[model samples]
Each structure stands twice: as structure tokens, then as C-alpha cells.
Target: MPTISRQGTDFIYQQVTRFISGQISSGVLQPGDRLPSLRRLSDRLSISVPTVRQAYVELERQGRVESRPQSGFYVRARARNALMKPAPCRDCKPAPVRCRSLIDRVYEGIHRPGVLPFGIANPSMAKPAAKGLNRAMKRVMARAEERSIGYAPSDGEPSLRRQIAYRYLELGGAVEPEEVIITNGGQEALSLALMAVAREGDVIAVETPTYHGALELIESLGMLALEIETCPEEGLMLSSLRSAIDRHDIKVCLFASALNNPLGSATPDEHRQELVALLEAHDIPLIEDDVYGDLRFDGTRPSPARFYSEKGLVLTVGSFSKTVAPGYRVGWLLPGRYEERVRTLKRALSCSCGLLQQMTLTEYLASGEYDRHIRALRPVLEQNAERMTGLIGRHFPGETKVSRPKGGSVLWLELPRKVDGGHLFGQALDENISICPGMLYSPSRRYRNFIRLSFGHPWSDRIEAGLETLGQLVSGH
Candidate 1:
């Protein structure tokens, strides 16, 4: 997990605070939405009851949520003053003593006059698809009388799930309609997957330079991580994975088979097939993150982990947030073996998706509108990634080595050891660049010299100017 600081408060309390804040920001905990009981939260996140209570006390103090005595805690209606961001402590938390993610560093580097950032993965939204999507949402709203008011299904609408399953085929993964479970987003899908398969203190094998978000999830669940080094060209290094497996007992290995976070490398078909075989031979399960499966800019889509093993050993996670209307927060997972367990977890959490969202997406996907939108999106993403890479080459220091991913919107950069990006974060914030640092991705807290750059957002003149500014900073360094 990205090394986060404790605010002199206990760890559980701190985690509870951040959890509520994100839920509030995302509207998941709608205005007046009742929060789960302290006992419930304690059991859920596996913290002490008192720890959950302390966190709630802080939330109430800030008016972010309310306590109604006998009834329970309810989400307080706080006016979002964009200025009101949650502070971790009296001071903004800096990088930990050891860096965790290079994605974090790219964000820091962008704020300076130097430091060209080839970090953070974000898709550009200024394209025919985005414009078309805006129109599509408006069109859907035009029939609000016929839409909007219906309550949504708890396990997601049948139609939407089917459509989502169909989209999987376009990407080369065979997903049956019954196998799909719609979620609030990829995060929810992942959380459900974790809850379904793992218990407290279970060991989950993760890629060496993994996504920090996944690492955070593992830590939150009181789990230990076994890191496996992956190659730049071949993606995950299975030889090391096999060695780790033989040496230690593990619960599951979570990986991105297509374009992974930060690194943006695609695991080849042979390696992917090998991964499935290795896991099956070892009787280990895998959580395959294919969120960026549809964003490939060139060549055939890489095969999902599902191809080799159809059962519970491989659960393929997907999300429309990156591809379609991000704000819709629609995502799904094809849990081959753990299907029932994952569904049960989803029901416990939020009880399925909004009816209107499901309907809109179902219509979009079934009508073949989704494929056309993706077809339009891919080229722009390719162009943007190429453009950013060119900029980094011309601007960043010569010691940096950047990943040339075939698809996806993120570029992972390997910087010189002379740079400890965690140290440079405060300075970057001063310049207002707002990029995600690189150290947030690793579990062992190394990788202080890497960064993740987002090439997925709209490539406008302003963004281009920001890139130039980022380039100049790296050149100056």
C-alpha cells in the first residue's frame, strides 16, 4: 500500500476517516444515507469497535456524517465547498520514509518548472466518443419520463449484464451473460472479489510494481503481500512467481493481464496461458484486472486469464468507467468459480446498480453503440500516448527509460537513482500540477525513482502547455 501517515490517531481510525470521505465524494453514501453500524464496520474492515467509533466521532466533528443516537450514523448533507478537502492530519501527509509508488512521483514532477512526467494513467476525454457520450446521456435524459424513476436491481439488471458480457467477446474474452455481475465501478468489483475469496491475513501475490490501490485493499484486509518481479517486455515474470509459490503459501495472485496500471505492459498470450496453467497446477486463484482491456491502441487484444481456466481460479474484472461514461460508475466481473460468493458480497455492500444506469448502458451496448464508441476512442488514445512519449523523450533527463506500451493511457517511467521523487513531492505541489506520484504502486515501499503518466485525458492546448512545462522541468534537472 502507498505509505500513508497516521495523524497521531490510531491506524483504524485514520482509515475509517479516508473511507467515509471517498464514499461521500463519490455520492455512494448519498445525502442522509445511513452508514453501517460501528459494530458492522468494525467487523467489515476488521478493526476494533472502538476504532470505528473514534473515526465516526471525527467525521461527526467535521459535519461530514451524523449520529442519531439510537438510530445510527447517517451521512450529513455537507455543502461541497471544493475548497474543503480532507486533511490527513494537522499537516498534509508527505511520502513515507520509504517510497511505495512511482505513479505518485509523476504527479509531483509535473508541478515543477522541470521534471517531465511520463507517469499516471488517465484517458483523454476529448474525442468523438466523449462528445457522442455526452449526447447519448442527453438523449437518455430526454426520455426521463420513461426512464429515471424505476428502482434498480440489486444484482444489476439482466439486460445490462448481458450487454456487458457481450462486450467481453469483442475484447477476446468469452463471458456468458449469467456469469457477469455489475458493480458500482471497478473498485467495487475488486472489493467484492477480495471479500469473496480472501480472509484476514491471507497472502495475495501481486506484481512487483503493482497498483497501489490494490495494495491498499490488501493492507486494509490485514493481508500480507508476496511480490513477484515482472519483466518490461514480457509483463509478469512467471519464473519468479513459481519460485515464490514453491517457497511460500499464498491465497491468490492479482494481476492485470492486458495493460497493467503504471507500467502499461500487456502480458503476451504465451505468458498468459502459462500463468493460468501455473495457477491451476498450484490450485491457486487469480483476480484478473482487465479494466484497460478495451483501450488497446494497436494489435490484437491480449487474452484474459479466463481463457486458460474457466472456473474459480480466474475472475476477470472489467469497468466501463474508463471506456464509457466514467461518471456512471458501471463495472462488472466474470467470477468463473467464485461467482456466487462475489454476488453475495455485492448484495451485502450496495445491493446492485441503479436501474437507469443499467438501462442506459444496456441500450448503448446492445445497440452496438458501445463498439463504435470504442472504435473511435482507440486511435485518439494511441495518438495521445505517442505524443506524450515524444514529449518526454525531448524533455525528460536522459537517464529515464519509459515503457512503450502497445495500448492503455498510462506510461511508466524509470528514472535515475539520483532522484528520490518522494522528497520532491512537496515542491511539486507548490507548482499546482496535480499528478499522481509513482511510489504509490509498490507494496515493499521501494521504486522511488519511477512515475506513472496519464495519457488518457483530452489532449488540449492547455494540457499540451502543461506537458511542455513538465518537459522543461525535467530538462532543467
Candidate 2:
């Protein structure tokens, strides 16, 4: 037992927390190991039982341990098998996207009725803001009447644009309402940003295990995607990016530097600054996908990479699809120096988004209900993440590696090499359980033995059973 310092500035509970954390770090206490009882630990450490209990409670809040009804606190088996190694990007050359068939199959599985959806990455569905949004829409209809149903401007509603600008301002980023252009969703924002910067046959740099939708968009535009090595924990590796930039005639780099889609890795702000400086120095544009920026478990909203840009080469994409209402299809883009070009593309493509959805979102943001819903929603997602990770650790193969997300609502699993993710997806679908095969996430089909599972839905016994069945399938194969 470590002796607690009485005269030190640190509180006794904090000291206890550190000691317990150190034990866990050093493998003195393994996952699922029962912690010492509060009374027992207090007696051993010569401290009050309340102090020890406080430490245990703090640990529980951190997702390090859980307390049972009739049992004491125990370490959570959340991520004993964490993905530490970066996924390999061996032939990091520019190639035309060719994973469309697998992506089509994955989408088919995701939309199948009565199937457990583990394929989609829809986070807001975990704790839907339906009531608040409906109320906001009702208020919009009552106020605007017939105008609510009319088409919004090509650049979106003014009130929603100002609200977005205010949010960026709150995060210490100077974004003018005029600079914000609303779109159909983040997908359209990405498409507009891509079109604004690069043209057909242009080579776009993307993360190795990138989002499937980005690949689809690149294919449709007749562009080639060059894979850049991405760390499962830290996101796009700067060194690998520098190497790719040196070797390829990269026109534009599209990345989810804030919070990645499948891996849920968040790049440090300092790293993002270096990334921005690196690209700006070369005069190459960076389109940052920040749709999942506000869903971090810690509630710390990372400043947009555009905030670090000195040459105005960074374009930011954000949306309410992942956070608020996906079906509403309201998203925005801060198009840096290419604002006029993006506006033109938006006008040519979708013209304008739904006026009612824009007005409802504007009301949602203005009335303080959006922030309240976000605060309430984050904890539920975090809890769901913990539960899903723990269950995966319990049921998956011993060699399985999973990404422990910092936020968002999905788990990326690297199963045994013999297990084919595509085959597993088919098998899971036969059982009426939908899962996303890893091949869809990459243009090169590198993640053949991997899969991404969504924990975005409300937790239930059905989900638990589906996970268990999925585990059994993996074990049998």
C-alpha cells in the first residue's frame, strides 16, 4: 500500500485515485479484478472510508471501473485489447476508387428492416432529440406559416448561419456568418469543398481506413484517392502524410482530423496546427471533416483546423446529422478562401436545403435547447460505448483488437486473420444482424479481416444477444 501524504497540496482522494490508476497501468490490477472494499482499503491505507469511496466513485466516473449492486467495485474490461499499431498503408499510391460493390452491399444490410443495425454510424439516434426538434419545428411553422415551407436561400437561412458562426466564435475561432454556407448535409458540404478545390483526375489524399462515403464521392467525380497511413489512436500520421505529399501530385487532402469516423481518433490541436502549416506551405488545400467534432466523451470541442490556417487553405465541414437530426439534412461549410466557388456549386447541385428543417434547427440553436440536448446526449453515448466495449472484450476472440473511441458511437474491430469481414457480414445478415465490413472503409480493401460496429442505437437485450451471436460466429469461423 502506498502511503498518503497529509501535508501535500493534493487531496487524499486524488492521491488514492492516482495510486489505483498506477496499479491498473502496471497490470497490478487486471480488468474484471475486484478492487479492495472501501472499508478494507481505508483500513490498510490509514484513511477514512469516505475518502476511499470518493476515489472509487471518481474511477467509476472515468469509466475505469464499475460498481455492482451487491458487489464491490471492479475494473471494467472495456479495452484490454486496444489497437496500438497503425494500420498499414503499404502501396500508398493514387488509385481510382473501386470498393463500390462492397459499399452497396453494406448499405443494403444497414437499411434492412428488422435487422439489428451495427453497420451505420448514426450517433444522434442513441438519444434522439425528437421532442425538442418537433417543438422547434412547430414554433417555426406557427411563426413563419407558409414561409416555413418555402425554399431557403442557396446559402441557407440567415439565422442558422449566424448561430453556426456564434458556435465557432465560442470555440475561439473567428467565423463570420457570411463565411458559413449551409448545405444538404455534411456529404454535400464535402462534395462542394472537393469541387471547390480540385477537379476530375485530381489526386486527393485520404486516410487509409477512411470513410466509405468519401471514397464514393471521389469515384463519382472521377478522382483518384491516395492512401495516407492513419494511426488508430491519434488519426492521420503527419510523417506518412509528408511522405505521400512528397511522392504524389496530391491536389487536395480530405481528413477527419478532429474525430475520425471508424477509429474515433482525435488529432491533437498542436498536430493539427503543424498539419495546417505543412499543407499551407505547399499551397495544397485541406478539407477537414468535422461532423463528429462535438461528440467527444470529454465534452472538449476541438478548435477547427481552419482556426490554425494563416493562408486560408483549410476548409471545414460540420453537420447536425451526427449530433441532432440526421433526417433533417442540415449541414454547413466554412469554405475559407473558396466561399464563392462553394456557393456556386451548392446552387448548381441542390440549390437550397429544406426551409422547414433549417428554420427548426435555427429555432433549436437560438432557444438554448440544442446545447441542453447535447449535454444530455453525450453521457448516454459514452455509457453505450463503455457497455459495448466491455461486451466485445468479454465475447470476442483473445486475439481481437478494438479501437477504444474517445467519442462517437462505433467500434472498429480487428478480428483473427482467418476471419473474413465480408463473409462475416453476410453471415450476420443471415441472422438479421447488420454489420459493416471493413472493406467498405478503404479504397484498397486493406481491412479484409476487420469490421466496424455501431453502438449508436439504444442499448437493449436484443443488442446484447446480437453481439453474443456475432461473437459466436467469429469464433466458429
Candidate 3:
């Protein structure tokens, strides 16, 4: 790793990215592997997070690595020359499955402009100018011009990782820069972390009714998912996890502790403590996804399970894609004991991005504007969620159940028996509304009557009208 300047926050990202990129191109690293998580890289390189983020952005732009949807950045499929080429796109699938799967249809059609999209998971910008992202991009352009165009680091910016660590520390975690590894996105971080901890055919445990992305990653890796029954309110069930651990040769526990997928539930502090204890006892590590942890509409900043577990098995994955800036493709990880493995995985995964982008992010993050923006956003999201829930209760005919989350922006809806949410997905599309049918959520067709509705977007009369139409579709009216 290159020596980083600790004076300015952004400089650290630059040094780290440079070192990593050089390592990648010079054949010092190989592909089909992982990278050090953001925290680890930062601490080791002694840089800030924005700097790390800048390097990661450059590497991503240069196509050295690719980010899997819910997985972390990995070395390009073929390392060496591949880093000089473009990585695969998010929708890049080896083989397409145009299924009669109802949930698939709904998810596919959700993004159509006219449709009320319940299948989408991200927050929408009412006007592109809401977050001043344009300003940040302009600054990046300026930096790139000032510096000679060269390869960034495989590990990303030390400074950006430091910033990530700082943010984590602020969020109530004991993290150092070395424990961080800047990633292309939260998903990439997650996928890479899981890959580091578990391998193919391993019996990895996942919370029941978990996010589809996690399940898909596990399946993609050819691992057997040991389902851990989680409570509707408390999130992951620790007792059940212990039972599963005793019965199986479990490798890793993939969980969404705060703002869990589809359910919008936050695991309690007490439960988290117990979970850490149990996992430590069993010697099983946790891959914790906290991507939505920052968007706590309920104002309760949910603490992660990593805080309680000192054994370094709690690998926390998070990203800025959800709240602050999505287009930038900035994400990070705090992998406890799996630090070296994560770093190696990241280096193999195409290295990291440019010095310019990482530098810009360093400015963006350290600018002190993030908090103000988040504060402005939180209320809007909370209100919209409430509005959608109210509409669902008042309009939908069946005994539809909803999960009231302490955090996150998505709502989980459980339709009445035999309602066939999959079928409703197609019907909703016809009404110009998209929905996340529960069939897409699990490996099995268990929650066929369930659907996930995203309320993070700007609420307008069109949204209200769309919800009304959806109600009609679900009720067969």
C-alpha cells in the first residue's frame, strides 16, 4: 500500500487506490477472489473513507472489478487484462429466465414509468438536484483533470475507508480504518464477505423470510441454506440459530439485523447480544447487511450485532447507495476476523476505482452536509410510509398484514390466504402499478400471498391513485 497523507481526508483514498491498482496490473494479485473490507484496508493503509471511496469509484469506472447486486466488489471474472476492460452490468445474467413466475413478472414490470412500482427497493430523487450530487460530480471531473489518469488501488482509498470507519464509530461501533474495505456497493461487499467466510455446498444459515439477494447469493455459490426462523418483531431468532448450529455444520449466518428486507424489522439490542454470544459459541461468523441502517425513519438508530461480538466474526456490510448517493456506486464493509480474506477477495475482484472519485467523495462526506440532507429526507420517508400503509389498510379488501419497521423505507405486506400475490403482480402491472410479490422473496413458494411495497419515493397524487388501483387489482375488482 502507498503511504497516505493523514492531513486531508480525501488524500488517503488517493494513496490507497494508487497502491491497489498498481498491485493489480503488475500481476501481484489474481482474479476470482475477494478484497479486504473497507475497515481493514483503511486501518492498514491509514487513510480516510472518502479517499478510499474515490479509489474504488475509479477502479469501478475503469472496469477492473464488478459489483454483484447484493454482493461486494470482487476481482474481475478474469484478472490481469480484465481490469482494463468493462465489468459486467447489474442485469448481466449468463442465462435469462423469463419465467411464468408471477413475482418475477411483477418485479420485471415494476420499473415501467406509468406503473406504481412496489418492486423497486431504492429511494427516488423527486428532482435530480435534491442532494447536490451534481456538484460532487463536477468536483470529481476537476480532480481527474488535475491528476494524471492512472490506475487506482485494488484496496481502494485508505482515507475513504477511514471515513467509513469514522462513520461507523459515530454510529456506535468500535471500528478502525484497517477493518474497512471500500466496495463498489453494499451488495458487492456482502457477496464478497460471504464468499470469504463460506464456500460451495456449505450449510450457511439465513434468517427465514430473508432478503432474496442473500438467498440468491447463497444459492449461486451452491450452498445449502439452513433457515433460521426469525421473529416478526425482533428479527433473527437467536435460539433457533443455536439449534440449527448444533444440528448442522453451519459456516456462516447471513442476516439483515437492522431494517431487514421485506419485513422492515430491526433486531433488538438484547437479541443482538444473545445472537453474538450464540454465534461465538458455535464459532460461526455473521454476515450482517446494514445498508438501510442509516434511513431510520423511526429515529431509533438500530445497533448492529457486530458491536456485541468481539470475536471478529460479525462482518458488517453497508452502503451509501440507499440514502446519500446511489449513482456513485460507493459501499463498504467492516469484516472483523475475516479482514485478510475480504481484502484478498477485493483485490482479486478487479481492484478499486480512481484517485479522483475517491478524493471527491472525501470532500462530499467530510463536508458536513450529509447529516442535514439525511435529516431532511427522514421525515419525508416516514410520512410516505405512513400514507402507503394507511392506503393499504383502507383500500385493500383482503386481510392484508403489514410490517411496521423501526427503520428502512420499504414495507412488507402479507395478503390474505390463497390470494396469490404472484397473480396480483400481473394484474397490478395492468393497472399501471408494480408490486414485489412474495414468491420472489424465498427459495420456496412459501410467502405467495406476500408482497413488498417501497414507500421511499416521493409521494404524490399519482402514488395515491396507484395504490387505489393496486387495491382494486388485489381484490379482483
Candidate 4:
């Protein structure tokens, strides 16, 4: 969605190219992974078949992926050289959060007008998604009965719950409609899941440089966060997780199942299976934040850890915010064995989410437009991430190390240790640009020399200028 001139002839082709490149960098398209057939991909992304072909040809030219006469395009094995995985943090003990003020300051600058938005993780509202949701909302509003404006069932609108469960079927998840509890957003779902399994003063295992919101919630709830080292591309390091498990009484482990923030790592299928087994062995519950699971650039969605939890120990949380509509504020939780407890918590939290929003999303899903919109959206996101990473590499210091995420819209950068991330944040803000300081991502102030940049917005000359300014600032201007 980066600001491309609508008049540009190669807009669609460029989108496809960036999407494929992002998939390659982010590990969504593993080495030698075959890409979708042109016809299938064109149908899937709702672009012209020729556009997909042209994009693939372009990728071949760049050596990002390759093609054969009979076989389809496969990600070139050499493309792996572009991705650099950061060394995992070593401290595995629980650390009390102390970055509240820094987080609040970063968020304050995030929505300020005229500032380059390289801070928030969610994508900019694309036209197709906006139009689809709007159409659905108008239809629902016109047909609404008096009940449509009243409080929804605490478990959420039945139709919406059913649609959520059905979508999970694609991921091989066995969520029943009755098990889905709707909440305000993924945040509420996570809060409910944590409350269902753990109490105050308990320790929760989390990925290093994990979602700041999770750390904030844990701090607010009087819980301690045991930080586990996570790989830049593959997500949580299971060995570190196990070590933390042995060292601390981790009541619950909260992690991203796909497209983790900042690092943009997606755990492979094998890792997901092993992660589930490890936690289940210790009788610990796992809360999986899968809000970004649907935005994979590889065009093939990865299954969440909850799909592997046969013993009902995995609580899966997701939302429409990241993909469809953030303003809708609609999200759900598959509470596993703690359904009743989560339902009670939802009722206690806000009674119910906005009824009309839930109804609108249900309508949107039923119309089968969600698939078309997601297909289009993922390519745009991948394109944006690809461009942003390239910009950072070209403009930032040569010693900088950046993560090549398989999906998601954020890039994590490890700058020279001499660089001060806090100062970089202040300088960027002074120039009307916003970025997330890496220290805020950890409870123990790790990654102080790093920063997380969001490529969720459409690219533009102004964005390029901002990056140039950031480069200058980072180089001690």
C-alpha cells in the first residue's frame, strides 16, 4: 500500500514482485519452496495472470526465486543470504517491566499527523478492505433489528463465532463455534486467556523482544515476565523456553505462532509441534497471539501452535484489526479447556463488543470477500516490508543487521552497539518521524541498540526522505 501512483503502469506487477521478495526474506518461502502456479496465484491475489507471470519473471531476474519449464518457480537457495538472524538474548529469568514511560511516549508520537508512521505494527487501511467492510456495515445497518443495537451474547454473535471457527479449519484448527469467545480485540482475548490460566504474582514465559502490549499487561496484572530468547526468523527458541521452564514456575507461556512483531519470524511446522510438546510436558498452558497469522507473504498461511494442542492447553487469540478493520475492534479467543472461565471474563470485562461491528464482519466473511481482500492485502504488506528493508540497508549504517521476516510489516534492526536507541528515538521524533525503540520490547532493557520500524504505511518520497533523515540521525548528525 506504499503510496504508488495509481497511474503507474507496473503497480500491480510491482506489488507481486515485492510480495515474493518479502516471502523469500521472511522465510515464508523457504529455500527451494515452490511458488503457486501463475494461474492459481493470479486468481488467489485477484491480479491478472500476466501480472503474476511478469512478477515472477522479475523475481527470476533478481535471483530471488527461480523457475523451470515444467516445474513452477521455487525460491532460490541463494536468496537466503539476505536474511540475518540476531543472536538470541541469553538471560532467561523473569524480569520486571520498567519501560512503561518509554512505551507511552512512543505511542503518543505514533498517531501524530505529518509524522512518518514507522512505529505501529498494523498495516494502513487499504481500499479493498475498507470498501468491503463498509459495504458489509451498510447492509447490516439497513437490515438491523432492534436487537442488533443491543448487547450481543457474551460469547459473541453466533454467526461471527461460526465464521471464525470455519476460517480456523484452513489452519487445521479444531475450534468449535461454542468454544469461541469474542472480546474487544486481541488484547482482551489475551487478557482473558491469561486470567483464565494464571493469577497475580505468577510468572509467564514470553519471547524476548515480544509484543510490548503483552509485557504491559503482565506488569499491570502483577505478574512477572520470564523472557526467553527467540530466533530472528524461526521465532521462539524451544531450548531457551525449556531452560526458562526449568528455572521458573512459568504458569503460562505467551508467544506468537506466526509473523511475530518486529522480528517478523514465523515458526516452522516442526517447531510448532515441538513447542507444543515441550510446554505440554511441563503441564504449562500456552497463550498464542495469532493476530498476524493471516498476513503471511508466502501466500500459504502457517498453522498456529493451538492447532497442535491436542490436550486443550493452548489458548488461541486473534483479531480482525491487523487484517480487516482495526476500528471494528472485534477479536476472539478459542479458550481450549478454559472456555467457561474466558466467557465469564469477557462478560465481566465489557459485557460485549460492539454488536454492529461483529455483525458486519460476519457478513463480510460470508460474502467470501474476506479471501479476495486478504489475498490482495498480503502482497501489499509484503511489498511495503521489502521496500522498507531495502531502504534501511541502503541508508542506515553498514554495520547494521536487519531481520528478514517471512511475513508481518515490521523490521527489527540491530545497529552498532555505539548507537543509542533512546537517543535515536528522540531524534526521529524531533524530525516528526516515529519508531519503536528496541528497549521497550524487553522487560530487562535488552536490544538497547536496536529499533523496530513499521512498513505498514504506503511508501512515498516523504517516507524516503524520513528514512534519509533517520539515517543521518543514526550516524550522529
Ranking by TM-score: 2, 4, 3, 1
Worst 10 residues of 2 by lDDT: 70-79
Q: Give the TM-score (vs. native) of candidate 1.
A: 0.73
Which lDDT tens digits does candidate 4 get at residues 1-477? 233334767678897888778877776675446788999987777767898899999999987776755657866544332445545566556767777898889989998997788888776353237877889988998899776789888889999999998988866766789988998999999999999999888998888778899999998888889888788877778887777777778899999957678788888879988999998888899999999888877777878788788788999899998888888889999898898888787888788889999999999999999988887777677656656666676678777777877777787888888998888998899999999999888888878898998877766788779988998898883
The segments of candidate 2 whose C-alpha lies over 4 angstroms from its true place after superposition are 1-50, 53-75
The sequence of per-residue lDDT tens digits that candidate 2 reaches over residues 268-368 is 88999999999999999999999999999778899999999999999999999999999999999999999888889899999899999999999999999
* Model 3 lDDT on a 0 to 1 scale: 0.69
lDDT score for residue 298 of model 4? 75
Provide the clashing-pair count of each candidate structure. Answer: 35, 0, 80, 7
How far off is residue 182 in model 1, in Å? 0.4
lDDT of 1 by residue, 296-344 (tens): 7653577777878944589888888777766788888888888788878
RMSD of each: 23.8, 5.8, 21.3, 8.2
Better-scoring candidate (lDDT), 3 or 4? 4
Once superposed on the true structure, which residue ranges of model 3 sit more than 4 Å away at CA? Answer: 1-107, 124-131, 143-150, 354-357
TM-score-wise, the better of 1 and 3 is 3
How much is the lDDT of residue 147 in candidate 3? 59
Model 4 off-target regions past 4 Å? 1-83, 124-128
TM-score of each: 0.73, 0.88, 0.75, 0.84
**Residue 54, candidate 3: alpha-carbon lDDT:** 71
Clashing pairs in 2: none
Give the clash count for model 2: 0
